[model samples]
Target: MYELSLIALIMPLIVGLLAGFIGSKINKSFTHWITTLGIFISFAISCWILIEVFLNPFLSFNQNIYEWMSIAGFKFLKRVF
Candidate 1:
């Protein structure tokens, strides 16, 4: 679930960065195709995740990707759900 969530979130960023970096060197059509494909895949993954969550309401998706800070017995974590 976390993997799917992260992929759905990061796929666009990765694809955009890649497309932008190679946009000038590659054919415009190729870049456009890749960007569109990336967006579609990300959207599909997101829809799947939503369906899974809806089907399993008791499923816990609390995942901590990073711990930002810890002070005075308090922890600040970056969570993805």
Candidate 2:
């Protein structure tokens, strides 16, 4: 599930990068299709995760990637969940 969540999170970034590079060297329509496909894939994964959460209400997904700063005992956490 976390893997799927990662894919859903990263798909658009990867797609946008590839589309930018490919579009600059090729046809615009091809780039459009590539981005659309990426979006669909991400959306599908998100929907699946949503369904899973609905079915199993006890499931939890939380990731603390970094603690960027601690200022005067206040912590800034970067989380992905």
TM-score of 2: 0.76
User: Which one is best on TM-score?
Assistant: 1
Residue 46, candidate 1: alpha-carbon lDDT: 96
lDDT of 1 by residue, 2-75 (tens): 78888999999999999989999999999999999999999999999989989999998677889999999899
Least accurate stretch of 10 residues (summed lDDT) in model 1? 56-65
- Give candidate 1's whole-model lDDT: 0.93
TM-score of each: 0.79, 0.76
lDDT of each: 0.93, 0.94
The backbone clash count of each candidate, in order, is 0, 0
